[model samples]
Target: MKEMEQPVLSVRNLHKQYGSGCAACRDARRERLLKNYCPACGTVYACQDISFEVFGGEILGVVGESGSGKSTLMKCLYFDQEVSAGEAYLYAYQEGRQNIFAQSAQQKRYIQNHLMGKVYQNPLDGLRMNFSSLGNIGEKLIAAGHRHVGRMEARGRELLAHVNIPEYRVKEAPKSFSGGMQQRVQIAKALSNHPPLLLLDEVTTGLDLSVQASVLDLIKMIQRDFKISMVIVSHDFGVIRMLADRTMVMLDGRVIEHGLTDQVLEDPQHSYTQQLVQSLL
Candidate 1:
């Protein structure tokens, strides 16, 4: 896909608070402690005033430590969690900026199925463990309005092969596969619909070093081949270094810094980002 000047995804002032508007939650937002959890009202500011843009065919990396709310940012963009406030627009869905946060359930469903694909850090969160690899992909296709069993299975098999799963194993349950393979299946399933956007949250987090490299390689290859835009969230700078064209450094759910990947990595300005870059050195 050719690069476009306009962003494929534009998110502004997004917030995801766990509890209803209590004084604690309001205070958390006011204090800018987006990662804070208050015992007073049991509110967790999982994400706050998060804003960014993902250009077409670009892999935008979001890096932050645990509890920094980077994952929550991706979750909000993927529509897995409801946003408490703010607006998000997917250019693929509409020309005018549509506040996706205000969209109806049906509209959200359409965006998820037709416009974006998501792969989670835990394969279990993304894949149907009990189903065969083919069945798993078929389910995603079915959600996208595919009903023909023959065509669905064929597309599923093709994707399994693309992901380097043995053709014979296509009939086997994903639960029986190794962790890395399960992740591969999840990737294949996510790509079945050829979505314009992909959301990957710590996809290589727990794998062995070599396995992580392999999975990361596959992701890079998929991006190159499909030319899909990706929002990848990881704490590992190595992953960000290998995959992202641009990078965003998140802290307390806020994007403290964002720029071209090399520029940000090489010349970090924020104190937190400077520390993060040095630690990886």
Candidate 2:
């Protein structure tokens, strides 16, 4: 048998905590409050000893309830939150190296530009609400080296259309579109540069079933067409069953069970997994 290739992204013993007593720890507490926390303990550990690997051309789904660390892990992986310990390695082809922890601003820029794509729970947060859908998608392409501004606009329109948005809506501000339409725009933005790894954090939250399914179909099509590795964090088992090759069950910042999606779905071993499956049923 041919040996499997290395994963496009690898995380080991990753830890992220807010409000450590270390003098270097600044007041992330305010940010936490803005996110709907009241008198949030500074010592909250959102992710503890988390580890995972995402291979090229595969989808890994993370399933958990709210406050279960799914979004926290994504935040840490995307470098939006500070990691307290451990390392994450991102594959970089041009320099022929794996960037671990990516502390340097230059390193972060390299990954953000070339290797990573992200979609957030609130689609508007991922896009420039004031910009037209075309402009929102075009911004990333321009940043990725689309030198001709005219070509950028044309390309943006094409991508928006691909996501099933009307070409005529391309020039309208994202704020004017419905939530689902804004989500399509966000997906278009994330796909603009075609990064090897796509991180989706609760991509379908707050939408109606039909809207969620439509967005999901688009994601499925994109994954199949581009063969990009995806890490999707969702509370919905239906979403995981439809998208994942493997599934990881998280609860209280720890992985309870993980394996082939079918294997776990058919016969979950962990008590938490069994409970979650039963609840869904």
**How well does each candidate superpose onto the true structure, as a TM-score?**
0.93, 0.88
TM-score for candidate 1, residues paired by index? 0.93
**Worst-scoring 10-residue span by lDDT in model 1:** 27-36
- Tell me the tens digit of each residue's lDDT in model 1 across 77-182: 8788878888988888877368777889999998888888999999888988999999999888998899999999899989999899999899999999988999
lDDT of 2 at 125: 64
Model 2 lDDT tens row, 1-281:
11277778878888776665333333433344423233434455566688888887899999998988899999888877777887887765443254456458676766776678899999756899998888887778776767888888877887888899997778999899988898888888888887888999999999999999999999999999889999999999889999999999997667888888999898999988998788768
Cα error of candidate 1 at position 32, Å? 8.0
Per-candidate clashes come to 0, 0
Q: lDDT of candidate 2 vs native? A: 0.81
Clashing pairs in 1: none
